[model samples]
Target: MSAQAHPPVVLYDTTLRDGSQSEDVLFSAEDKLRIAKRLDALGLDYIEGGWPGANPKDDDFFRQAKQLKLQKSRITAFGSTRRAGSKVEEDQVIKGLLGSGAQVITVFGKSWDLHVSRALGIPLAQNLELIFDTIRYLKRHVDEVFYDAEHFFDGYRRNPEYARQTLQAAYEGGADALVLCDTNGGTMVEDLRRMIGEVTDLGAPLGIHCHNDCELAVANSLAAVEAGVTHIQGTINGIGERCGNANLISIIPNLKFKMQRSLTLDDEDLTQLTAVSRFVNEMANRPTQKNQPYVGVSAFAHKGGIHVSAVLKDASTYEHISPDLVGNQQRVLVSEQAGRSNLIYKLEELGIEGVDAKDPRLTELLLDVKELEHQGYQFDGADASFQLRVWKALGELPNYFELLGFRVIDERRVRKDGQHPMGAEATVKMRVAGESVHLVAEGAGPVDALHKALSKALRRDYPMVTELKLEDFKVRILGNRKGTEATVRVLIEWYDGRCRWGTVGVSDHIIAASYDAMVEAVKYKLFKDKVKPV
Candidate 1:
């Protein structure tokens, strides 16, 4: 059905509620408010704020959220349906939901007879009463109430009649939306399609929530949408309890562009998809997956000669959709497996013009890159290092600074003062412009002390160094060599507010490797600013 024929698909985000169930994905009350506002700005229909009274954090989140002026999305207070024997008015969870000051409330109730009997240890009939009375009761207090039929797919398959009865309770109770959930996330798309058809008479707007255990959450959600379900409930990047919820990042564009279904996200909001995805991943302290469908770093990256050549001529030649459609860009990656087109595309992307594809420097650069990669210097994740290599090949970069020498000392002692103390001291000597600068500093660790001393020395000559800061540092032990002989690979990520880049270094000594990566980071900063070393 066309979007004009049906209502725009409602986008319900449970990131603060269901997403927090994910392992290690806790968001403070402040984080929840921030994300809620962002999701609202993204044109979402509902933001499930978390279970009030379930925890102090969620309670405080609702409190703070009420104080903010949300523009579009409704902040939903989530809770479980009232207990089997408890009166809805006497339920503290229901009271908390009312007090949450949210315009909407969502509660999950047992849909599967197995869950009713095994988990709640309640009779099937009593579970239906919980689903009915809880939503019916909340409908009086809240502007909108959504009923979540937990494990609806599995329950429907196990006992189709009982599942429909549970949904019937929700429909009779006046739930604005009846959400079918794939709690186990194992239901196939065809089965979901079939089940959706069976539940059409439940008497509420249908929604779908899915987990990603079988890696079919996004597909299953889409299947439900195709079968006439209008609400799509999921989390950003699919981060949630088990595998995760369906990925809204993948689903939004899929519905808007591919299926031709209307969604809450407008053109501007759609363009911010990649940025919003990265922002959420950053808040979760998770690495953004480079291959994550539309928004990933490698989503539209091309490396092969034929692919790069065709892509450069007409991106539609190999790309299923324009990268910018989802706020992602086409990338030409240069590696040992790449061809002349890769070099040309990359150089042009970097704004290095006037170089022919067959230029000898291009061959030299590719050869050097392949040899370095063979030596364990990964340029793929180290974009700054790759840029430095490009400048070196193009003969445009100059030595910005020279590291004369450095010494690190680690000392530990028990003093007469009855104190056991440990400390690290680093001395750095570097030549900037035409003068030598030396600095010494102490830190909790050798790397920290070295970083301090380096910063101290560089800030005097290159005041712009103040803006350059290391965002992340990683060290990997490479090879089968034993003890100190093992190769140390250090990768450092640097950011100057306006941009961020990564560099890598490999050496036998950890400190040496770190220093090499640190130097590359500084060089990248200078290179971007059009500065060169004397």
Candidate 2:
């Protein structure tokens, strides 16, 4: 069939209502308001705040949102249709919608015959009546009313005529829009397309809501769009019950840039999509998905030799879209799998360039680093300090400071015959700037002794060291088949109040690796301070 001549697509974000159902996601009423304001800034067409009658927090959210002057998006209150055998005028849920002060009201009614008979314990006829009466009542109260036919796709597959009748009920009841929901998240893409076509043939403004049980939520939403649906409903990060609702984070750009659909925002604002996606993830206290379609951190990162080389020639060779188009910067990851091009790219990012494409030494160094990385050293995540070490090893780095010598001593005594126990003591000495600094301290362990001694020695020359501390320390055994003879790799993450950096060290002895990582951490902090004037 020829594509229907539909108006520009509208994005209805359910991040607050549906997204909160995500496992481990529970946003307070205040957080909901904060996210609502941010969603408004991102130019969402509609925001489904929450089910106001379902909980006290949602009620408070509606009350709070009424005070804000959101210019672009309308606040939508979500709820279920009137209960079976209840008049719309008497249903408490319908009354709550009337008092919510939302211009748009979204209510879900059962479309699946199974849900009608089993879940709601009502006859199919009463289910259709419930949908009709609820929509008609909400239409009288609000200018815009959307009827979410929950399980519309599954219902269509099971009882196509009954599902169509439910849609007919909402259409006849004056629903401004009808959203077909894949409530179980089990519908296939081809079925979704055909079903959406069937509904569009019924002559109502169509919308699509899908969950990610089969990991096809984004594809299903897009398929519906391809089938003449005008409204797309989903959460930001595919966050919802079970798997999640369709991720608008993946959908918006696909629609705007790929399908050539308009999103009611200008191109300039569209560039902020990636940033907005990250901002929402941050507010939700969840790590953004690394491989998320349009805006993930690794979406545009290249590591393989062939992929990086091709991407350098033309990003379209490997990337679906330019990173800059979505306000995301491209990255080259360095690991055992990386090639010379990846190293060169990383070195250039660090403002160092001496190796050439055909340099024999470049290949030798790459192979050596890769061999080392295969043993658990990740230089990609620690590129700053890794590059510094590479330059130092190549005799290209200027020596700003050199470690003359260092030592640590610990003494402990135990009481005997009721005598008091003598305290333990540790001492460390290091020479810097032609001056020798020595400090004696007590610690419960060798690692603590080393940390205290080093900090004491460096405090005079680097006062900022006081602000730095180890955030995380992880030790992994490399070549475990070698047993106790295996090498250990240590990763230390340091936070210096403003920013964080990671450093790595590998050695047969764990203490040695720890000390090496410690030295790199201090040097990295100093280097950053010298270069950035912080």
Candidate 3:
């Protein structure tokens, strides 16, 4: 087929609707509004807000969506087909969907005969009426109506004749598009592609909605598009029930750059793919997966000497595509795996002078980094500590401050709110500017109390430390050691007004690991200021 053979594929983002089905994913009204704006900015064709009348939160989202003016993407309200044996006019769910201020309405119906008989407990004929009347009635009220044929691939496999009839009913009812849903999400890519090829002439524009149970959601979605499906439904970062739905972050770039097909997002919008992925992950408060396919932190990070050397020569050697094309940058990671050339490359990137490319000292530096990593000190996620290591390697690290001693007291007590909260108090003493400063503070946890006490002691001397706020704190257990005996690796992310950096520490005690990382964070801030004298 030629490039001009098919129209542009419409990207339908269900981050609010199906994405909420993901465990631990809860979006407030403000979060939904923010994500909707981001989808609009990404130039997605459709943004499916949560189903109306499902809950008060979804109701609030639709009410709030009315105030926001999206420039490009249209807001779509989702619902199911009219209830079994109920009038489309009297169906409260259908009415709720039309009352929703969205320009488009999507109603899912039973495509599989087993679902019609077992799930709905209704005959196949009545289910067909439900699909037709629901789409037909809503089409009059909404500008566009999409019918999601739930369990389409499985249904087609079981009873192809019955599945075609259901789709034909939707087509006759005037649905603008028919989205084939892999609700159970277990269909193979080849099976789904063959099924879609047979169903393309059902008298409506075709679409694909997939789940990642088999880890083939993206592949299956592309197969459908190749078979002339025009609409693709997915969630950002593939957040959904069970495994996940298709990940738009992967599909968008694949369609535009790899498949060389037309999509709603242009080249510039495509570059923001990583930023959008991180933005959504941040809003959900989920840790960004470093090893994810396209937009992950480690997607473009090169650690081995062979890979880094070749990448420096020509990035296309090991990389499939330019990382910057998807808003990610190449990283040269340092470890025992790195060669002398890698160390030289890193020294040049860091702008550190006097380090010869062939310096024998680099071998010791490399060994130290590898040993630290072996002890659960992860330098890849900790830029601040890594900088400290580089300075120590050159024997030029400054003595920022002298820690005298620190103590922490944690107690469990019932508060006035009738809640037994952990009461934590910490004392920190440090010598700064030739003066001994002692401070005490209390917090909800040992780490918080320690940070507060340390900040209080250094407030007058290092006023910039107050601007450094811990953004995220994570602890990973190392090796087979279990429970309290386990060695812990603590990674702390800190952000000043302009810049963000990570620090890491490792120890058998969690609190000790946290304190070590926190100290690195403070020292790095002070070091940057002394270098620039700002």
Candidate 4:
């Protein structure tokens, strides 16, 4: 079907609702409001706020969400059907949804005969009444009512007749959309496509909600759309219970760019895909997957020499789509496996100009990278250190400060409470602007003490050095067999208000490795900001 002929697929985000069920994820009410506003900016059709009566956090979210001014998305309040044998008007769940002040209401009810009988301990016919009553009652108060048929796929496989009857009840009760949910997330794509077709005769607009247990959530969601469903529900970055919900981050681009399906998201909103994905992860305090499809850091990164060479000439040779289309950029990584093309591409990316690819110095620089990587120096994660090497190779590196010597003393003492407390002190000597300076500092640990001492020694001549703050420090043992004596590689990430950069150092002594990485971080900041010596 032509893109214009088919209706634009509605984007429903449940990150605030289902996504909070993920392991160790706790989004404060403030976090949900912020996420809702961001999703609204990204042009989502519906944002599922959460179940208002389920907990105090969601309750607070709904209370504060009243003040949020969203431009494009409708806030949805989710809840379950009224309890068995209870009046829909009197049910607390129903009352909570009515009081949530959301623009839409979505209620899920049992579709599986097993859940109706075993879980709810209610007859199949009574369960249908509950589904019909909850959606019917909510429809009177709200303009839109989306009915979620929980466990519909498995229920359909077990008792096809009962699943259809459940959906029919919701449709007859005036639901605007009937959402078929794969609660267990185990449905095969072929089975989903075939079953979804059978239910279309009901004449209700269909939606698809999927989980990722079998890792087919995205695939199954797309299959449903191809089967003529218009509404697609998912979470940002696919975070939810068990595996996760379907990832809209992957689904959005696939629908817009690959499957040629029209989406409610505009072309401009498509560009915010990566930023939104990362923002959700940040709020959840979860580590981002660097290899995640379109939004990952490694999605467009080329590591192989031949691949980099081809991509440098024409990106389409190795890329499936322009990374710019998703607000990402292609990267060439330098490593022991790097060829001349990798070096040239990386140097150009770092904005270091005037070096010819055929220059003899270029060959030497490539060999130096290989030799250093062989010694446990990885340039891929330490771009700042690699840029420094490029400057030194070009003979344009200036010495802003000279490290003369340093000493560290660590001591442990028993407190009155019988707790052992350790203290560390560092003394650093350096030459700055042709003057010798010595400073002593104490810190929580040896690395912190050294960083403080170095800052004190350099801050006189290089005042901007105060801007550099060590954000992260990681140490990896290159040779595990030697245990404590093994060579360690230290990577230090520094933030100087504007941005963050990483530098790497390798040595047998942990303190020396840390000090070297710290020095490289300072040097990179000085060079990049073009701070001249006093």
TM-score top scorer: 4
Q: Would you give me the overall lDDT of model 2? A: 0.83
Compared with the true structure, all predictions reach lDDT values of 0.88, 0.83, 0.89, 0.93
Q: RMSD, model 2, all Cα superposed? A: 4.6
lDDT of 4 at 531: 84
Counting clashing residue pairs in each candidate, in order, gives 2, 0, 0, 0
Candidate 4: the clashing residue pairs are none
Which RMSD does model 1 reach against the true structure?
Answer: 2.6
TM-score of each: 0.92, 0.87, 0.92, 0.97
lDDT of 3 at 342: 70
What local lDDT score does residue 195 receive in model 1, on the 0 to 100 scale? 96
Q: Which portions of model 1 show Cα errors greater than 4 Å?
A: 402-405, 413-422, 427-441, 455-463, 479-484, 532-534
Residues 345-410, model 3: lDDT tens digits: 778778886688666677778888888887878778887898888887787777767899889999
lDDT of 4 by residue, 249-361 (tens): 99999999998898878888999999999999999999889999999999999988999889988999999999888888788899888888999888888776667889988
Highest lDDT among the candidates is held by which one? 4
Give the C-alpha miss distance for residue 208 in model 3, angstroms.
0.6
* True-vs-predicted CA distance for residue 321, candidate 4, Å: 0.9
Model 4 earns a TM-score of 0.97
Residues 273-389 of candidate 1 have per-residue lDDT tens digits of: 898899888787788999999999999988778898888889899899887877899888877777888878778878888898788999899899888766667766788898899
Error of 3 at 8 (Å): 1.6
Instruction: Please tell me which model should have the higher lDDT, number 1 or number 2.
Output: 1
In terms of lDDT, the poorest run of 10 residues in model 2 is 419-428
